[model samples]
Each structure stands twice: as structure tokens, then as C-alpha cells.
Target: MALSPKTKYNIKRILPFGVIWLILGALFLTVEHLALGNQKNALNSAIKLQPDVVLFALTGVTIIGLLVGCIEVLVLRPLFDRKNFATKIISKFFIYFFFFLIVILITYPIAASIEMDISIWDQKVRNRYFDFFLSVTNLSAMIQLGFSLIVSLLYSEISNNVGQNVLLNFFTGKYHKPVVENRIFMFVDMKDSTTIAEQLGTEEYFKFLRSYYGAFSNAIVKNHGEVYQYVGDEIVITWTLKNGLRDNNCIQCFFDMKSDLYKKGHMYLKKFNMQPDFKAALHFGQVTTGEIGVLKKDIFFTGDVLNTTARILGLCSTYKEDILLSKALAHKIMLDNNYSFKALGEHRLKGKAAIVEIVSLLKNP
Candidate 1:
């Protein structure tokens, strides 16, 4: 079967790892060849660069990558979403142990079979099928390979936690210092957030928030929204101007998040006795984007646009509206027919002398 969208996205996130292990595999081959120290006969040298060996090494690397990637995305992603640090550490230890062993079992057999064939064909070494299997199960090799797999998998867990793009920017220094760029910001917060938190009590309410954000994450990725910050009960998501306007993605991401959470209403009601509903405010403008920190670096946005977008969302409760958009953002696009808009009229927002036009965006009846 073809990969699901989520699977495809996770795989895309893990693609660079394939090259990482490919390099390691090549290095391992070079080291092994050099370890022979001029003792190599023709067959030994030939065995070192054999096409079958290259395929075996690369294939093994790829299988380990996919195995670790899938585990990180499908299994560990949800596991880390919970608030308990102690439980996560304990659970991951056992989970990874068996999972990596299973990966070894599935991949090693085929590789070992290939190596046996290559040996007989090229070096005229006679080895029984069982001997090939035994070589694959060699204690030292398995331990070293398994250690590498565990280390790589653990790195994946950390990378996933920091987020894919955030890690990239950290290494590439894409925004080491502030740089101005046009970005669209969507400020989304739970409706009646205070009342809901009180009703659910502190612990349950936090869990609700976690689950709610988890639901929102899927929709944001589906629409290509990049999350900038989470302030208290609100989350600030952003996009490049082009990406935000490409297919009305900024507008659609809000509704999609709502739909996802709505579908989980029953589960929320059963567990927390409440379901979440969120309101969003959107605006497009210039912002300074870059990484900042002395001890712990992080990618951050700074500009009036960020402040203005927050103020737009601050009006949602005042206007009693679910979706609000700045006139500047609305004017840039030819909205699809599925959407309808209402002019909220220009208003002089607090702390601003000039009036800013606003609109309510809604689905067509």
C-alpha cells in the first residue's frame, strides 16, 4: 500500500539520516579494508569493494533508518506528548530494546545470505548456510551495530522533540541574527479558556491542553503552518507570505484544527468533561526572524506584526467571533468560493492612533 500522508511527512523528516548512515557504512568498509594492513590477497581486496557488499551495507543502513524513523514518528511522538518525564524515559528504554532487536532480525538474515553468496562466488570460501547465519549473529558485530542503532534512534528522538525545521535552522544558522521578512501569523487560543480550566481543575485541564495542542499540530502540518511560539493558552503559528497565501492555507488551517478537535469531542467529554473550541486571528506583515540566546539558542520572531496579530486575536472575544482577519491579509488573496467574508469596519484599536480594517471570514452556507 502507498504511504499515508503522515507517514510520508515523517519519512521526509528522516531522509537526511539515510545519508548519515551511508557515510558511516562507507567508513566502516574503508576501515575494514585498511585493517588488513597489506595482508590482502586478490580475493580479500575484491571482497572489500564487491558490488554485493556495497548493496548489503547500504540496504542495512536504510532499513535501520526507516525502522527508527517509524518508531520515532508513530510510537515515540505520542509517548512524549504526555507530561510525565519519568514515565517517558522508563517506557522508551524497553520499547526501543525490543524494537531494535526486531529490526535486526528482519534485516540481518537477507544481508547475511547475500554475503554468503558473495563469498563463495568471489573468494571461493566454503561456508555452510548455518555458518553464514552464525556470522551474522556474531556477538561483537551485533553489539556494535546495535549500539549504533540505539544512538541514532536516540538522536532522532531529540531531533523530533526540537522540531524538524528548528533543528535545521540551528545547524545552518539560517537566522543567527535578526532578518526582516514578510510572514503571516495566526494567533489561536482556546475559547473560554479560563472558565474551561477552572471547570476541569488544574491537572485535568493541563492534559486537555496537551491533547488539544496535539490535535492542532496535525492540522498545522497538513496546511504547512510553522509554529512560532506558545504563550500561555495561546499558540502563535506562522508562514512565509507566499506559503500563507498559496491556497488560502492560513485561513484553512484554523478551520482544519477546529474540525480535528471537534472529531475528538467524545473522548474529551469522557475524560475531562469538556471539549475544546478555539478562535483565531490572522494578519500578514513584515517581521524580524532569527535565532537568539546566549545559553540556549532558539529561533524567534520579533516585529510589530507579531504584536498586531496578537491584538487582532484579542478582539475575538470582544467581537464574539470565531475567525478574524486583518484587512491587509484579506486583500492580498482571491478567496475561494467556499469562503465568505463580512466587513467588521475599521476601528482604532487600543494603543494605536490609526484605524485598521477588520473582517470576519466564514464558510459559505
Candidate 2:
């Protein structure tokens, strides 16, 4: 069975944890070998760093990493997602520290047994395990593991806060210098937002918007779209030209989001005494992307396409359509049988000389 979008996203989020642990495990092994080389032969027998020991350590560390990831995803996230970074780090460290102790207690015996060619239940294995655990080598390894866990937790918190893609780009310097690239933009604006807010009042309207915006996440993730910005009641989603065209993801995202909100319409009515809806416009053009700001850096996209997309979104109410795409962008997309398109004819947009043709798209029943 295919995984849900959220599941896929969670997997992506959890993978880094496993990778981080694997690297740390290898590093620990290398450090152990170097440290053992410096120590007397008498200490080497207490904690053997054999081939089997190496494989077992790496495997155990990876499994522990995945378990830590699951704990964070399933338990820690929902409980402390809204908390401050310090609080999250503190909580995660303590929880993972407990697991770390459990791992050492359990894996040491098995590792020792494998090295000594005896069953873990044997008293010799237990004696060796305790000796190793109390040694300075184990103490050093434990300290390193503790530090690695903290680093991993910090990475997770920052990656989540800045978005995985954005964080990667920052690390890779993909947008440090301005570069122009063809990209697709979708401007989704909440319909009748002003009226809804007035009816729901300020506090309730805020809650309504929260639920409404949250509904877009799954669809956007499934379609490989990145949320560029949220402007009041409107949101800007963007994709690379290739990504937008693949499987007609850009168009499919709109329908999926619409379906999701429709599914949640009853909840909105129950909680806020109203249903919220959105209209979107799609356009594609060249845009310059770059990082800006010294105090707080961020990736920024600047282009006429964004403004044109916004203007096209404004035409949605006039054309009586929920989704409108520029004729240029519509022609580029290899639309599937699931959708039907209607030409909305040429129109002059404000602050532009070009008369651009527009098309309205609908999902066929």
C-alpha cells in the first residue's frame, strides 16, 4: 500500500537521525581503535574491538537511532512541538539519555560475548561487560554518544524550524549568490476571508485560519510543492518547472487541497460556524533566488511571475472559477484525462502591457 503524504514526510524527517547515528558509531569505532592503540595490551582484552564487535556496534547504533527517531516522531513531537527549542532539546536529551543507558546495558553483554566466544548468559561475559562499562574507554564513548545525541537533537529542531529543503540549501550555499531559474508559482487566496473573519471574530478567526492553512500541508507535500510564504489569508506555493509538470502535480495539488478542505468542511462548520474555501492561480516564469539578510538570513524569490500570479488569482472571482492558470503555463502542462480546461480569453492585467490569456481548470467527474 502507498504511504500517506504525512507518512512519507515523517520518513524523510526520521532518516537523518539514523544517518547521524551511523556516522557517530563509525567515528566512535575509529576513536576507540586509536585510543586502544595508545593504551597497554592489558586493557585491550577487557573490551575487544574485533570485526564482529564493529559490525554489532554499527548495527546497534543504527537501530537505536531509528528508535529515537520514532520516539521523537510519535511521542515527543505532538507533545512538545509548540514548546521553545531549549525545552525540546532538554526533554529529548533526557529521554534519549535513558535509552542510551539501556542500550549500553543491553549491547555490552552481547558485544563482550561475541568477542570472548561465549553466550551472553555466561558469568564470564557479565564480568567482562561490567569491567568494560566501568573502564575509561566506555566512559569516553558514553560522553561522545551523549554529545552526538545533543547535536542530532539540535539539528532536528533547526531543520524543522527552517524547513528541511531550506536548511539544506543554506548548508549547500545553493542560494548564496543570486541565480535565475524557471519556476512555477501558485497563489492560493482564501475566498470570502473578510466576511468569515467578521462572522467568527478575531480570536475564532485565527483558529479558523490555522485549521484552514494546516489542511494545505498534505496536498502540497504530496505534490512536491514548497510553501514560499503566507500573506494574511493567502499562501504562496512554488515548485521547480520539472516538479510542477511531473504527473501534473501542480494542478493535482489544488484539487487534493480542495478535497481535503471539503472533507473537513463539517468540522469547520461545527467549530467556527462556517466553511472556508480558497481560489488559486498558476503561472510559470524565470525568477532570481538568493539568500538575503545579515541578522536573519532567508532564501528569497523575486520575479514578475509572482506578481502576475497574484493578479491572476485576483481574476478568479471575475471568471467564477476556483482555479485559474496562465495560458502559457497551461499549455506547458501535459494535462491528464482527470481534468477539463476552459479558455477564459485574453485580459490586460494591471501594471502590465501584455494581454495574457487565462484558462480555468476543473476536475472532471
Predicted structure with the largest TM-score when compared to the true one: 2
Worst 10 residues of 2 by lDDT: 38-47
Per-residue accuracy of model 1 over 228-282 as CA lDDT, tens digit each: 8777789889999998998788988888998899999999989988788989999
For candidate 1, which ten residues in a row score worst on lDDT? Answer: 39-48
TM-score of 1: 0.84
> Which pairs of residues collide in model 1?
none
TM-score of 2: 0.89
lDDT of 2 by residue, 233-322 (tens): 999999999999998989999999999999999999888888888999999999999999989998999999998998999999998899
TM-score of each: 0.84, 0.89
* Local distance difference test, each candidate: 0.75, 0.87
Evaluate model 2: give its lDDT.
0.87
- The residue-level lDDT of candidate 1 at 343 comes to 93
